[model samples]
Target: MTLGLDEEHRELGASLRAWAAGLDGPAAVRAAEGDPAETFEKVRAAAAGMGLAGLALPASAGGDDGSPLDVAVALEACAHALLPGPLLGPAVSELLLAGGHPGSDAVVGLAPGAPDLVWDAPSATHLLLPAPGEDDTWVLVEAAAVDVEPVVALDLSRRFGRVRAPWSGGVAVTGLTRARVRRTTVAMAAAEASGVARWCLETATSYAGVREQFGKPIGSFQAVKHLCAEMLETAEAVTAAAWDAAVALAADEEQAAFAADVAGAVALDGAVRVAQTCIQVLGGIGFTFEHDAHLYLRRATTLRALLGGGDVWAASLAARAASGVRRRVEVDLGGRDAGVRDEFRTRVAEVAALPEDARRAALVERGYLTPHWPAPYGLGADPVTQLVVDEELVRAGIGRPDLKIGGWAAPTVLEHGTDAQRERFVRPTLTGEIGWCQLFSEPGAGSDLASLRTRAVRDEAAGGWRLTGQKVWTSLAHEADWAICLARTDPDAPRHRGITYFLVDMGSPGIEIRPLRELTGDAMFNEVFLDDVLVPDDCVVGQPGDGWRLARTTLANERVAMASSRLGVSTERAVALAGDATPAEQVRVGHAVALATVCTLLGVRTTLRSLAGHGPGAESSVAKLLGVRSRQDASELVVELLGERVVLEADDPQVAADVHEMLMTRCLSIAGGTTQVLRTVAAERILGLPR
Candidate 1:
């Protein structure tokens, strides 16, 4: 959900987006790089006239008070457009204001002499340059104390200057502290890096979409899509880290420092990766002086050094995080020990050694498999342990042997099954017994699964129920021993309350299962027809109309399953890919580290929110959006790096295997809830935007 925006900040972002979409943009920025006087004048005018420089500064400092989130939105827009200027200047100003400085005419300072750098010195009516010194006291030099010399910049639109200022300008504003300023500077650098990184990803993606190679959009190539995907991932992670810093700043100073350190390290690494990957996407042209790619790289380099570099920040954070913090705290048992650590390795290897038939048997014998299954529930395994068992199996690369609805159905039966029903049905499920499939979805029912029309009627003489209806997407039904059916058993009741969950024997007369193949080339989904099938009264689960609530538990488990799975590739594989790239591409591998760092930041944010008792919210949507975009970015980059060999789709076997990912990348935004849907969700939930 878009968080409700303050009208002014919302307008500011909209204006920036509108403005950046126009003109030659990066070309203009590139052209101005050589002419500092012209570029500075243009950027300073845009920033000041747009009122972007002091957005978050308090009103006491001749500024309209705003917040960091506001500035983030504005900067995100600027980054989206690849605009050059002080997107972080406002954030810096906010820090200054918070520190009790009311330099009504204060201007922020940066490392004074990088010609190609577009450092923050917006045409402030009163420039404040903090001179380098041994003492904690800041010597703020006025505009006149500064002598600006122009330098040729890679991005002409953003010229850099050499500033020579006196040791002191004006008295320090009350409340400004050296410690606060230092921390704020580091955080602002991270924010700037985030802006540049995102721009690189979006810019590269735009180019890939229109730039044709091999008679198709370059994005069609798996290598290209993956490169773009990776870029998106890097950008996303950086954004999250930066935002986490902002949130921490909002909450507490110490947390702010920690967050900023993490953000600075991650964003620095991400910026370099994004710049290099974008250049790769642009091919040979990206390396030339004529292109704007180098300009961004230059900025990334300058920023990386400006904020103490990644190593320094990372080391600092490591030291701080280790000090008195719970380094080995106990975690929730469900997802623990699934990594390739010692215990994880042993269990997986043991499971992997078992043959198909023996694996299930071994699992039953060893008490590792369905640890939660009720005695009548089929197999008696603890739920938490069962979750860990599945996790271990997946970690070991052991495919879950096909178990139809029986996997889900037996649990319902055991939970609410009769003694006779459990004796007859649950035993076979534990032995190399029959499988079961869920017959829940229908031609009209999907996300709205309760609107099912499958009917089951009482048959007094047969002492059972007769079912007649069709169920679509019944995975693995053809070889199932039973079907977990949800039907409209009480039509007069509320839609949700009217349904009943039942276990139907697959061998019953008039039941049919037809397989349907999915994008993965697997016959895992099917359509099932139940015609006059008889299910005894003992097969019904729970009370007659409580199926909806019971079904919710199963659906919730599905989500939990998805959330706990290994969501990305191994670090070893990523390192190998990085090793294969050129020296420049090795710099791109830093992007992988940046991505992982950002993922951690996202986890932190999610944890914080969850602690506050809220759902993942817009942050989750942002994470998802960023994930798909990053995957596409990485895909594109790989293809570009792979070069001519990318043309043979699935032809070389190795590269060809990636063809599926290439195809899948196109649908990344559309799956797991489309990016558009998520964007709307973010707008409503996070931004609190109007419908």
Candidate 2:
């Protein structure tokens, strides 16, 4: 959940946190506010002694030559403690210098452009300024060479000043490019932003848990819980985005700029939003000067401002994405499975050599289709092996067949069904011979699925169960060969209990499927009516009262499936539609791209955890919530880009598709689980907010 994932980075973060705590940064800031001359000299010296100033610089520059990720972890910890004094400016300046510039030990200020406010100007020994009319060129000058007019800034933690410098007097730094400098700056700043967001979220949630109102803890209220949940989402988004930006910068990949732009767009603004929400959660006490909440808000706001505003970053991101820049997320297994990888590659190649029609069966036979499942049904592959198989399959251009509803159904059958049931269903479903649909959601029990009214009565003469129920929003019901049905077996039992998981044949007598037209005018979903449909006793999964537990397993499988899904279709379409977009439209597109990227990062973090043999983190649930919003927003943005053309239904097929997509995405929030209900779940389960 923090910027650092592994043990080394965690240790570094912990060390920094301990170090920052000793500084009592807020008190130092308070002192600086009283005496501008008290510039925290000891604090700066301590940071320098820790080698943080040149953390990302090369060893030739007297730095440790650490990766940008290392710097990010340190910055995040420092920012969480509200550490003041010139960290960002000095670090950025060192990176820009790259060991060649003459001021490695000097405190440096960054003036992004001409007549721009310089950060840390009062204490800066040198200034980094953009070269006049030189397009991406920058110059380094001593602070004495420029005139600085100190400004009263919103962020009390740091000082700012407008600098008047002769552009020709500074030494032109040719080693660093504007793109490199900007990306580094934004990435590092985003790390700090994430820290601010993390602090806000933790502070708010902790305060809400104990803060009382109306004879109860405010966190017990749904509204407050939801607010804290939302703050968690934003804070996680900020962390993921910033972490990704640092990763990209350290790797120096082709799409590094795009990644940094995403951080700039999402992390900076998200931090500001989280800080503001933290204050809201803290109530009246948060609004006062004595509270530390506004300080974080000021810091977040300042970072966003210094980075050329969120809109600018968003537009840049959109423009880059429109030009076909995508941040590729690949898992690095660190050669741990060299032999396994080679074996997978050979097997995948063999499968690829088979006729396209035979590939699915080949994959299923070889256990490549469901590597994470148990042996025979799958390879019982660990997370690393699963990822390796995925990579090899993609490398061989072999796309795995989507199991659709069978994905959920087959998993449950494998885990909880009898041997005969697995033999009859799992392989056929895997091979696409037997299509499956779910009959769980009823008219009144969608998100509250346990409240389903479908009833099942035992038929002693028939030696099976007679089911009668109406299931709505059943995807692929009309085309499915079978269904996994949930029906109440005991009306007097608790809502969740007394239900039985049944495997029902779609062609059973008295079963009817009526296609339901969606807003997109498609009948992909259906309403299934079961009138005394008979399901054999052998088709029951687990015991009569085990349906709820089995249903949870099925839902868990669905979440796993969702987690492995690619970056959404809507995000890609939005990028495609972003060409020639207006600035305002670009901003929206940029925001969408940032969100989509964060969703991917969340998945990456989850995978990394799995690779490390750790349990799943909160990223999985957060990813689902954020993914729905990302897809919905992107799809809507696509329609907005269509503008007046959206009214013309069939005139332009692409426009029609865009419109349909927007409508289709509306189901994302409603389906699986409603956003509101999921938010409450996240509040209780993840954030530990009272229901």
Candidate 3:
């Protein structure tokens, strides 16, 4: 979660964090305020002794031969302790040197744009600057050759200075290029920003747990809980972005610049925002210099500024995306599933050879359609087998039929239903012969589904039950042959205990479906009225008064699906809209690209965890929350780009489609769970905030 996924990286990060903590970083920063030069020298020497300076250099150069990812892991740990001095500059300089430059061991300063101001100039023994009037050329000059005037910086932990020098002879560094230098710098800075964000989140959440107001902890309050939850989301985003950038940079991929731009766009700004929120959570104490909150805020802000601000990064990202550059995200798998993959590929190929109309039935017959389900119904595929099936299906150009509500209904039926119930529903649903609609939510109980008041009374004479309820926001209700309903079977029982799960025939005499038109003028959702509908005893799933538990049942055999590309539908559309975009539009597009990519990375991390035999991490839940924002924001940006055409009934079909998409995305936050409620859940359940 702290910019590393594997055990080795975790151990490295932990070791570095322990080392940094022992240094008393805050005290070091305070000491630097009085004697900057001496403090930096001492800190630099200690870092060197710890082998931190040579982490990114090759082993041939008497270094660790660490990749950018390893250096990022180390940087994240050091920054978590608020380690003072020039860690990023020297590491990035060594990365650029690639162990070829003779001055690799020296404290190297980075002059990204203007030579007048150089980062870490006060502590740097040499400087890397762009060659005069040469766009791609770079030069390395010794700091002793220039007149260095130390300048006061916002970040007291690191030093910056003005370099007074003429455009003269210097060593031409062939290893350096503007793109590579910028990407490397952004990747390292993002790692540091992630550490700052993580520390702020941890500090604020810890304080929230014990900080008292009135008669109890402030964390018990909904407002404070929501704030802490938002902080968690932001901190997670920063970590994901930073991690991905480091990975791409280390791989030396064609999309490395694109990934670095995303990191710069998301992590830098995200860190600053999280730090500010941390201060807000800490109340009056955070405003005083005695608190460490301001220090993190200063570091985050400085990183964003030195990297030319998030807007510039976002613009560059948008440009790259517009040119069709996309980052590929996939699990390495390490050939562990080679045999299974070959078997799946062969079976899938057999299915693919069939006529288009015969493929669905063939897939269902072989348990290829729902591979994650238990045998007979599916292959009972593990995560690796599931991925192999998915790849083979895609490779064979065979798209599985969407089960819609059946996907949810059949799982419960399989888990808790009678053998006869599974026989009646599972296979038929998979074969697309039976359609399902979920009738769980009522007008008054949407996200708080346990509050549903739909009643079911025992029909003693008829040997059945009489059901009466009003279900809202039911998708495909008009087309469904049956429904999975939750009815209050015992009025005397507790709220959650009284419910019963029922399989209702949608064609029953008293059922009525009313289409509910959305802002997009579509009727995809509906209201279903069930009045005195009869359901036999055989229609119920599990025992009576057990609907709540059955409804919440999540089979361990859940399907695993991953995005094929980092750019999602809305993000791709945003890129298409950026052809003639204004500067403001480009920034928005870039921000959208960064968010979408982070969402993908979160999934990638979660998938990686599963492949490694680890339990689910925070990424799964966090992905849902961030995904809604990313989709909604991208769609809104698309409509905005369309200008007046979005509002007008224009001849352009694309404009209307864009407008519709923008409106339809409004339901994303409200569908599975409202954003406000999810934030509360994230705080209480994930962060362990008091209810």
Best of the candidates, TM-score: 3
Tens digits of per-residue lDDT for model 3 on 1-691? Answer: 6887877888899988998899978888989989988887887888888888888778777678889899999899999999888888888888888766444367888887565778898888888887767768888888787777888889989988786656566789885778898898889999999999999988998899999999889899999999998988888899998998888886655679888998989999999999999999999999999888999999999998888778888998899888888888667778888878778888899999999999999999999999889979999988888888988898889999999899999999999999999999999999999999999889999999889989999998878899988999999998999999999999999888989999999999899999999888999899999899999999999999999999988778666775567577778988998987899999999999989988988888887777767767777888899999999999999888878876675668887778778899999999988999999999888888888
**Which tens-of-lDDT digit does each residue in 1-691 have in candidate 1?**
1111334544666777787666445765665546544665565557566676567767766666767666666666665566664445435655555444444345554432232222455343233344345345443445455665544444333434455533345655555555566566655555556767766776687787778876887765656766666666566667667665655556566666666666766777788899999999889888897776777787777666655566666555544443421111111443433452466458668867877657766665554445455442223433334445556677777655444456666556565667777777765776647677788888888646768899888788998778889998776677777778888877888888888888887888888788887675767678888898888888887877888877755422221221221224322233345545665554444443344345545544454444333555434545676666656655555555566766855478656545445545665776434565555444333433333
Top lDDT prediction, candidate number? 3
Better model by TM-score: candidate 2 vs candidate 3: 3
**TM-scores, all models, native as reference:** 0.52, 0.94, 0.95
Please identify which of the two predictions, 1 or 2, would achieve the higher lDDT against the true structure. Answer: 2
Ranking by lDDT: 3, 2, 1
TM-score of 1: 0.52
Q: Scored by Cα lDDT, where does model 3 land? A: 0.87
Give the clashing residue pairs of candidate 2, or none. Answer: none
**Candidate 2 CA-lDDT value:** 0.85
Give the clashing residue pairs of candidate 3, or none.
none
Higher-TM-score candidate of 1 and 2: 2
